[model samples]
Target: MHKNFTHILTSLVVVIAITSCDIGDNKDVNPASSFLKIYDSHQFDHAIGPVDVVQTDTEGYLLLGNYRRDDTNFLGTYIASVDSRGEFIRNTYVQGSNVHPVGKFLLLGGQRYFVSMDAVGLQGYLNQVDDSARVVSTIALGVTYPMYAENDGTDQFILLSYNSVDATTVLSLVSADGSIANQSAFGIGAGQSVEEPIIDHFTRTGRELPFFAGRASSGLYYLNGFYNYTLSLLFSDLSDNNPTGVVQGQQDEGGVSGLLSLDGGQFAVSRFNFGDSYTNALATLNASGTTSSNDIQSNPMLEWEVDAKVKMISLTLDGVGYVVIGTTTKNQQIVLHFYDQTTGNYVAVDYLGFSSPYQLGAIEVTADNGLAILGSIQVAGKFQRLCLFKVSEGELLDLVQ
Candidate 1:
């Protein structure tokens, strides 16, 4: 439940005529003009990448990511607020050993919270911040790789994490004030490990259903204690902690990087295959957690041997399609692929880069039918700084036409 940051510019006027430049192919497209603004983190020597972005009720934007003090092992989590015009309002950092923010902004009971993990990934903290980006409280949690968190439309939310010790998937129903209410664990069989659980809810038959996807060991037992890897999907009722269905992919080894709910028991997932060479694929699933369409590989845009990896995937607010973001192994440039959810067809692809390689972290549809992409841009061949791109909805649709 990574909150969409597209709502941040609700107060800003949408200018359909703004011109933009595509980094790859140097083509001039109409939607390219919709590139609104870009923000950079000047405080740190290197801003790793944005983990999440959210638009506040007051029309401001909150960003969560990591920053490095230098080219050393010192990594810190950062939270910042920006005005509707992409102007920085306030910025703060939680200094820790190799800290990386996980999940997105959580607005519950009229408060804002952001989650992150430490170097070892075993310990993490949820920071409560105000509109001014000031930390109000920090609640610690014992979890590694905090994958996803979704509210139950009440005072509680279900958090997905990985238990590094036992290699089990952990699900916890926690209160809005950062207190655990109930918890459950799912073991994917002995010698099999699970990681990167992404969760979302979709309305089907007048009821909202919660679904999750992640990577798990293929369960192909080896002589000692080895197992192949594959992607997994499951449908769960967070209220009672009951899992109704589970689905696993046929790929030899891969992990789900992004997930989006398309409603009516349908959703899309972005997966990275690590079986032989690095490849990416997109698939759609039905209510039963089963694949509804064939695996759509990166071959549509790049060859299978190009080594493309999808880092994030997000649905358009309209739920008609989704956008996939990642980096190409050769150029290391950030690449974005847009697809129609209904036909599962590729609409367009865009690349972004500065002087050095760009790493895309997160993307969300805006209130005005645009997209807000969060990532890091290398500056002067030295520092990697946080960067945000605002693309208008008109620009997005133009590419399809």
Candidate 2:
């Protein structure tokens, strides 16, 4: 089913009263120049949670999310396209046998596609759609759950799946037409691991590589890079591989949540620690995989004793720093933290949302250097609805009132 979703009327008024307060170096930044514009806030009849948002080739926006018709059953996946002004263009529900959509949107061969697993997670598929929101084709992928698809610069893509039955990691190189060109698997033995791989694209050298960062059974964080299409382990922390410095926390209770590429063959990673208290940390690594710097923060308001979670994170296009978004349990507000890479300073900390029960989905940088935060908001003490808004960097710095 499909419908023209509209922004919540009460949210428009709530946003105007919610302003960002500056807490860092703000001499040159203008808080007044910062503005929060609501492109659109949509409330779907069914419960929907956004996963990712990407700018279309035609300068529009496409939002991919999971939807549920009932509390117990998975309705399928939700796809929505909006214009530059956040006006609703069209939306459709791609029914699946699985409980959720576990994939990302890919733009390949000058076409748009939403690739994901079915409800049962045993099979994956790609929905090829036109600009007018019409599905032209649906390509099936014979894979299991915990799989992800990433573009390889060319029209082809790389699919990575973890086989729990055999304790193996499978890599498949898929062509643009949904055919698997090559497939391979690597065994990691019997261990509990968190697998979140990221594809890094370097603009200067036009090079791309995929790296998987997670916590192995050895109780240490490991980052492994793969050879293009071959699924060969280029480098890892294993005994045979040229292992770099292993990331060890006070307790082996945290795992990598996000990864960002930095200048000069360096990268930054975020980890969430759930020990006696909740903590979110950032670390930097050199090209050789050596940890250069590690900064950990636990519960910003220590006295309040509130729990804070790092829900999502993304680096700025210029690689200046990162924007960390999460929720504070006591205050029930979405917190934004701006980290300055060079100085190793948290330049700013701001808050959004007015009440508790606000869930954060994802964060993406806009074309004009602004930020688009995707999540859901509970209205009138009822159900949760999808909420999206853009905030300028200046606004985050408290330069604009």
Candidate 3:
């Protein structure tokens, strides 16, 4: 599919109200932006939405997530549907087996789909869910131990997995019917060391290690993950699933924390080493056959710094271009800084989650040209629950100006 840089962004979504949460011991409400309300999830002990959310044809939403039953390592799959106002309607859960779920929901042929592991056999599961928050069918995948997934904006999805026994990283192109179109593997030098972290991805700061796979605007298939013992952005040849060039990194500098491939082959790249993380809003991708972490760090276009997760996305709004950067700060806040897409000049900034702590997860440009943000809120300053915030077009324009 041709990359639509002008289209709307959507994903796993839940919005908040100005009400106190029933699950927490402390009732802290974020009144920072009247338009920014954190949704309450009272049923689940813990709910995290690193998954995908899509707006239904009705202008409502279908959100997918991972929920822990009782603070265990295992996380069950949870699904919910909400109205256009971000009000909740219905939801369901698929109990966990071993590891946390990965990947966003894929919208294929007007149907909603997602790929993860089946709890019982621990096999890959291609699930088809209805807009009404129902899992209609699930096809078991031959590709096991799945890690991350992303749609090529066309028909197929980029699936990232691991071969624990072989100590290799697996990459596959999966069709809508749950069939593998093309697959490849590369050795992970220290196999057990890499595999152990993936198993613990859900429980810990899953943010430390980021997995990205997508088709860039330059018509290149690229994946940023473990390859040959290191985390590198491996750009592939057009025909085969093989790296033509690589933008490699060291384990010491924390590898690529967030990557958003922009037009003209450039990208909004962010990296984290230990506690500090920073982003280069306007950076190119032609890594010299062997680029390293030092090369990315030498970039002078530093946009912002944070001690937590940093994410970015590019969008063209009403004739103007923007590279929006969202950062989770060490100070218990989520800050959004917008920059001029063409010049990389700073435009505006907004803050969320004042009283209670928040960690940024996902962001989207809603169908109405508004903004949809996904974040995990510490309810009562302790219980972690998923929350979504939508900024109206009027509010967005005010910030842009």
Candidate 4:
């Protein structure tokens, strides 16, 4: 026991020495390969207009966003590629009325693709791109107004769209050729309407509609959106045109804020109501879908008010799994809470960009096992630009589990 204690103390000293010697330029608790970069054109009135970012197959980074102009005057599509060191490599801006980038890139059959809503047809389109950030081909989806696109846990895409005619959420299983294999319209009621959020996104009104959809491990498809005159998580069989189960919530004041799939048929979910943030660190899914009686969050990890956005992501570090809840709080900063996968207990909280305002876009795991967060920043205290915060793999492992 004496020898083991001495060896452990020596290892701790070594870790402290390395961290103190080599940290990010920010002077925060950084580790090797850690970086914080604000990526954009760097020209006046120029923004990268990032929506989502992904680590490319070449071990670099690719960001998908709007071409130019702000939310109101979108010119076309924008693709910015950065090297592994977070340095700018190339920027591709394609201005066209027929292309408007949506959803993050999905890796299908070893190829990366993303969905877009064409400005002309106003219909969802699947665009395949090469490694050089060039669009190889663009195909149109049968569904109109594709709000969110996700992989179906198989080889196809599960498009969560909206029908402008009836203001209902449309679920579709689409092929690579933009073919709809199976589709069903849901969440229709006498007074429920999704027309407001749909128009808000296209018009860049700045209003938000937190929508999420994907296939769970139980082979049931789940969608969190407005359904049955209230915000709910609608579960379906998809074989038939009816809902198999529905986890209902308050009409508009409360609902599922965010959801992320986990191993063993579990999910890490976040909830909010009247600006109060809550989270269920882990929940199981079944045929009827998961639900709660009193509060969706049994033990809240996020103490701040989540007024803007809530996102959850899971990562396995050194053979241990963890769930991280990220929020755009009312404090005008990005807050991330990491939790243990086995115990579902709160681990640590990281408050990013307290000096400047930051908004959450998407959270992803880097190729190096680090944490890559993509968001927008106010550059020079004025211009809205894309920013990335990469927490080194060592720093993250030191925090959770």
Candidate 5:
């Protein structure tokens, strides 16, 4: 989950089409568009990309990402606040290592905290910048292995870390005061890189039926490993480590492409299949841990072949979820997949085909309903154009739907 800086304001125009495929008849009549641009930091020598964005309790936006200089390995992780209009108000770069932040920002109490996956491992920090970007309190908990963290709102936070000794992965719940409330380990085989662990509170509270949602692994590296089918979900009390039970099992050896949890039983999960050379299904799960009535979203096929090596797939959310598919196609084109969860089939929605030679640098969603897509498009003879887009509902849909 990377966050992109740099904001652009572009007016949106609406239009309608007369297609015979009233097929679903579930789609909204009118769709809107918003264009956004990626944060350009080369001017300052530090390339800044949007990692992840979360809406703060203060009605402001928190943008989390890292900045690095091409001349040095100086990676800087930061958290900044912006208004609803996407105006930068304050910026805070985390203290210590110059590493990148790899995950989403979790809302803890009146404050917000997120996990910073750096050159070393994963470290936890806050976004409240006093003077500069400093951690109010930081901790290096869990195995040095890849880990995931989430906020539960009940004073207890949750984490999933891969354990080498046990040849298994453990899920733990930490209290608000920072204590290991509970923990449990599950064996997903070994030698697998389990990066994204999604946690949801979806069972007990009726409102909390499907609690945890994320990707796991069976350690099938190479083509199979990149399949993006190793997805799972825990639908129990997030305050507890084991969370009572899991609502779903590891389906495809697929990766947990993207995750989004909404109120009620509304949540979205994206699954990608690189081995097959295309972005597959985007499923919507209900509060009951079951796929929603319109569970599967299968639309807009994204199959691009660049320099020959197919680009990996990544997921993000602004006000909505976006599925970005990158490819080694000759032009280095990165395909953008957008879906309108309100009335989508849970598959790939609309797609925008942007061609560049810089290779997709960073892809993230903004809290202000914008998309921060960073990469270089060949310009003149050099790939120097930092692309940005403020993506909105029905906009991306218009392209492929």
Candidate 6:
């Protein structure tokens, strides 16, 4: 399953385009019949990409992340606001040269926060933008990638920073106005960083933890390390380190490079098992930083053991639970998992697969009640055209149709 890492690197680039969206969740309906392409760019110029889409509470979506003009090029942070119909309302680009942020734009309360991990020296800034993609406020966190931003549920933001040099992690509480209220670091020389650290969910009380899934000292096997909310250390023993528990489990866990939080105190760490053998396992966390004691506790959620290598996973649990999974398959085939929020189970839906491969770069669910898919399409076998897929509640339900 070892691929030419060099070639697969192109999957990291995201391109953008706009189109009209039809509303409706009837699974038996044809999504394309009412699907319109609002913004489509055959090239990356004047085009923003590597975009992370988030829906606002007002039914508008904020497309946040960074975009590059070309290979080895860096684009500053970007936040584009789109209506529920997937039409662009406004787009804003942050002021930075080499600051290419690498994680998804996080939404807390009514504000949108994105970190500039690609910026050197200073960590990055947390941004607050309005529905029109205007920067409301910005706060700086020293040297942290995949910064975990969450609202304490009371107009407060809990920001976590991971310091690879000291092998330590820190947590801070910033007010809604982008001011730091409290800060603390738990681990000193415990957390390991392989290139960068990945932070997951935070509680309304300003608690968060980092989930590690990098290689072990052996350099042959993989390891999973869990850090506490206060950035304290936990899960030290490698005895139970096997991601799937069975140490020699046939499934390869090395490709799992990121972690994400699910609503109701659950977090799913994604691992690319290489090739079509990709698997995402759900881990339930307790207030004390321990995971549920279930072997493969929940369903694998996604099991694409054929042609797709899942690259990014987006979860929306506020309303009806839905998952948008992006992949590296040449066909650009994306899988949407819809579940009953109350039951934490899939809602028995069917999605018609697109015949040709489409490169799905990044997918985000906005607070405005819509979903945005950003990526490039190969036209006539030579054009890397930017394309977007917008789905409403009804349009989502129409997938099964």
- What RMSD does each model have against the real structure? 10.7, 9.5, 8.8, 10.3, 12.0, 10.4
Model 2 worst lDDT run, 10 consecutive residues? 199-208
Model 5 earns a TM-score of 0.53
Q: Rank the candidates by lDDT, best first.
A: 4, 3, 1, 2, 6, 5
List model 4 lDDT by residue over 1-401, tens digit each. 65554455445434433443332444654332676666645344554455778888776778777655544343367777777766678777765655557765777777778887777668887888777788788887887777788876446888888787776788888877778888878855654243554466555654465777888867778887767666677788787657787766666566777888776778887776655667788875444654532245455434565546677788888998788888776666777888888878788888776455678777889878887788877644555667677778887876763
1-401 per-residue lDDT for model 5 (tens digits): 12222211111100101111221133653211243333233233344544555554443455665565343243457665554433446666555553445444555655556655434433433233222224576555544333456555546566655454665546666665556766655554434343323211100111111112232221100011111223444444433333333333343332333344533444444343433233333344433333311224434333543112222233334344434443333345555444444443334533333432434444444443444444433332332433333354344444435
Better of 3 and 5 by TM-score: 3
Sorted on TM-score, best first, the list reads 4, 3, 1, 2, 6, 5
Stretches of candidate 4 above 4 Å error? 1-32, 46-49, 67-76, 191-194, 285-295, 300-306
* CA-RMSD of model 3: 8.8
> At residue 77, what lDDT does model 2 achieve?
69
> What is the C-alpha local distance difference test score of each model?
0.51, 0.49, 0.66, 0.70, 0.40, 0.44
TM-score of each: 0.67, 0.65, 0.84, 0.85, 0.53, 0.59
Candidate 1 lands at a TM-score of 0.67
Candidate 1: tens digits of C-alpha lDDT, residues 50-128 = 6677766776578777665543232467777876555678787665453555655777787888765555444656777
Error of 5 at 346 (Å): 7.8
Candidate 3: where are CA atoms >4 Å away? 1-34, 42-44, 47-50, 70-72, 96-99, 202-208, 238-242, 297-307
Give the winner by lDDT: 4 or 5.
4
Tens digits of per-residue lDDT, candidate 3, 253-286, equal: 4567777877788887777655456567777767
Worst ten-residue run, lDDT, model 5?
A: 8-17
> Which residues of candidate 6, in runs, are more than 4 Å off?
1-48, 56-58, 69-75, 102-110, 177-330, 339-356, 359-386, 398-401
Sequence-dependent TM-score of model 6 = 0.59
